[model samples]
Target: MCFRKKLWSIVLSAALVLGTAIMPANMIFAASDNESQLQAMAVKSGTLQYGDSFKWTLDSKGTLKITGKGFLYLSLDDLGDIKNDIKKVVIGSGAKEIHFSFWSFSGDASLPKLAEISIPLTTKVLSGSLRECENLSVVTGGKNVEDIQGRVFEGTKWCQSTEHVVLGKTYIAYNGTGKNVVVPEGTVAVSEAAFQSNKTIEAVTLPVSVKKIGSYAFKDCSSLKKIHGGSSVTLIDYDAFLRTPWLDSLNETTMLGKVLMKYKATAKDYTVSEKVTQIYEGAFSKCDNLESVTIKGKITEIPRRAFENCTSLKKITMPNTVTNIAYGAFDHCSALAKISLPSRLKKIETGAFIFCRSLQNVQVNGGKTNTKLQSIEDAAFAGCNNLKTLTIPWGVTTIGDYAYGYTDGGGDENSERDMVQKMMWGDEESVPKLNAANIIGISQSLGHYYAKENGIKFTATKKGSALKKPTVMINNSGELSISKVVGATGYEVYDKSPYDKHWCKAGTVKAPVRKYMTYELKGYKYKVRAYRETSTGGYQYSAFSKIKTTK
Candidate 1:
């Protein structure tokens, strides 16, 4: 994809740039700011005063010169419509420091029409300075100049004007049009958008001294085949080579610094490297056939949308270093059956696990005392219909809307009960902070008057007896039976299938039942699980027991 270059406005104010200063209020000088005076000076004399601090002059050849300055704030917008009249800029030795924060010169295109800039050794161009002059080729006389910012001359026709690689302190651009390019040693960083949209150069070699590759450095380099050196490279920012054909050559791992940028593989099982401390947004998303993932690292947060829409992912083992799960991190993963949240987890952002159709269990640090969990954002567990068991930690003080409930007018009888039946334990005072207006199915069953007073609707009663998860086993006659029930009213039997999400209800077990309830099956050979009722008159169900298969 062709990423558009970022545009920065030239509008500057004294408060926005520095603290307070005595200068013209507007970014570009208007007609009242001596337009006729500047035009007459361009024709007759060559010098004019910009307030009292400095003097600016223009020669017959359209070469502008700025003489004396303590802190010169000369943006291209200061020239306005007269910007195209100037072809060269010369900063004399009298100037001490020059700072330019804007670069977008307005016209048919955004880049400025001027070419060539001559700066003395005493001046310095501050960081975050963007220059997109495409025809500027003569950039010299900077032996004593302070460190220049990267992308100072980016998107310029001078990028291909020389065969030798051009660098600004540590940045690399103007890599030339050669089929093979070699970077010298001792380069520290490649600035953002340095080599953006270059469609040439087949191969390149880098020295071991290079580090830090910036965002979109090699974007749109379609003919570029390979990058030969990245041994010392760390900290490559987002979309460094976004539209490059080289991404197709990456197979097992595409890592830069401690962040795992992208993972593209056909394997069923994948393991993250021990050195990875962060996973960027959308790194492993849309992997349709992944089954197991093992992360053994010091990663602290799962970023936004890190694993969304991975349909076939079933298992993931998170290390204890993880503390925060960002918004939409694992949404729409249809095959994930269960997950053991890290013990040190503190925050679950909005919609972290929404729409996971087969997610049955989430094991966190349970119980009503001193848990690490502090918040669960809106719809964090919404649409997880099969989620049977959960332990809301005591430390949870904030719960967002629809945190563990069904959407209005959505879900079937079993699905609705999936929220209403599950057990929740928390400090009584802290759970009241949950927003009642946005919650429906599950929050209603809690019977917190705060939920009802806030307009939550539910048919089930609040009070209920908690029941333990049951155990199911296949008998010698090939009949499925459930055992080990404490407080029960009835039982719901389910047929387990690998692909199908809906749990097929086989039969029911009423009260005064025997030690074991047997349900004869038309034997094909599949697994079965069951949920035992806990409340007498309320709608409360235990978690599904371990599956038992017919041999």
Candidate 2:
């Protein structure tokens, strides 16, 4: 299915190029009356390339024609030489995004001769692609564009003449002088910095169709006191309402629709409401007074810098619904001591828990077969000097560089000197060694590979080895009997009632005693596993036996 989509995209691009090439020569020349002057200049007509995917053509008539199937990459250097001669830009179909490089010098227009542009319906995002085109006046097409990022039409003649510049379903740039504004219906997005630095605007009302509010959308709107109709919004980018009176007026915990946007309360402990389905980046950042946080909602990911710099934070509890912990989610959380990862978590991004000086115990719940964790990215647990041991899950495949047991050497002079030398001369031995003394995981797993590669001692647990699954039976006296396999020092019994969410530890029996008293309640299930004492005094357990229900 994926291959077919790629083939279709390639075929469509070729057709777009062919369509543009077949335009009659007379039609191209008929647009200008000074044909003799155009011919005398000997303007070069060839392909201009940006990146690997985009290619454009400039004709002798000063017409720039853009043809592509994907993103549009524009740079000052790419068009700086011929920018003065290009008067018109015609974007052909199949271009999905447009990005323009910032001006070479502040307040200087790059394309002085550019007067008109035509965007295709395939373009969805226009990220300041035409900004600083001082002479640009006419804009055609782009009736389907969804996002207009960062003052896209700023300083253009077209934007200066229009009060509320909107392209398709996105509210682009706003130039209105009114103190209050109401976005029209059917608009789905308010682009980045759409109303940036507008001091007079005291209130703004959005239609229900708007789903995304871009970064710095209302930044520095000092007089803005109310933002109505945010119940349908699902995504709010970083600092969308920063430095605004509306944001200052909000309560400690600000919820825009289902997303938790900010947490400003000074309380020592806080629990997120269960209704929150998502958390914005830096939602609770720099909260030095916060000691503990409990997330009990349907959020699927912890965004970047969600709780960064919360030095007093010692503990955090998250529900199992979370899958990904983004980069720097818990960075510099010095007081964090322990955390229990969700069973369904898939990836821990780079620097997810970096500089967590007090972090010690990281518990990965669920059995080997149930946990879905896959990768531990670079610096995930770096600077955690107190962490002594970690048990990587069996499902994890990759352990990134410095994912665990790396310190930044804050107070120690020798370690700081070593760090500086390592950076200057690339001295490998000058770098501090892994802080974790012991690492445990299944044999031959990535955990074992990391330990071997780092010269750390590893304790590997062989699956179904001497500590095989114990034989569990219910005797006539209502007691559970377990027949253990060879080389077992003890047996651990677990049971779960029908209403329980997870199995609970029943009891532990030594090698000679294989029987355990059964629970009095009916409809309870039991399972037993054999464990052997390791050389380091840690217990290695075999897989649980087949479950047996009590009558």
The top-ranked prediction according to TM-score is: 2
In candidate 2 the C-alpha lDDT for residue 528 amounts to 86
Write one digit per residue (lDDT tens) for candidate 2, span 82-152: 88888898989988988877375767778888898898989888884566788999888998888777777
lDDT per residue for candidate 1 within 1-551, as digits (tens), equals 23332212222344358633544454345559666546554641233323226556666567778777565656555565456677777877755556654466343323355687787765544343535556677776654432334555555665556655444345546556667767766666666666677777677676776666767777787877788876766456556777777765666557655568778888889998787766766788888878888998888888778789888999988888899999889988879998888878889998899778688777775322234666777678767766644555434534565576443124455643454333222122222222332322232122232245334433322333455667766777765556746666556665644444324555666655523433444433333222332223224445557666554
**Best model per lDDT:** 2
lDDT of 1 at 280: 67
As a TM-score, model 2 comes out at: 0.59
The parts of candidate 2 lying over 4 Å away from their true place are 1-57, 68-82, 101-109, 149-151, 154-161, 263-275, 285-300, 308-328, 331-336, 340-351, 354-358, 363-383, 390-551
All candidates: TM-score = 0.45, 0.59
Off by over 4 Å in 1: 1-100, 103-129, 132-152, 155-165, 253-270, 277-289, 299-309, 315-331, 337-354, 359-551
Worst 10 residues of 1 by lDDT: 425-434
How large an RMSD does model 1 have? 22.6
**CA lDDT of every candidate:** 0.61, 0.78
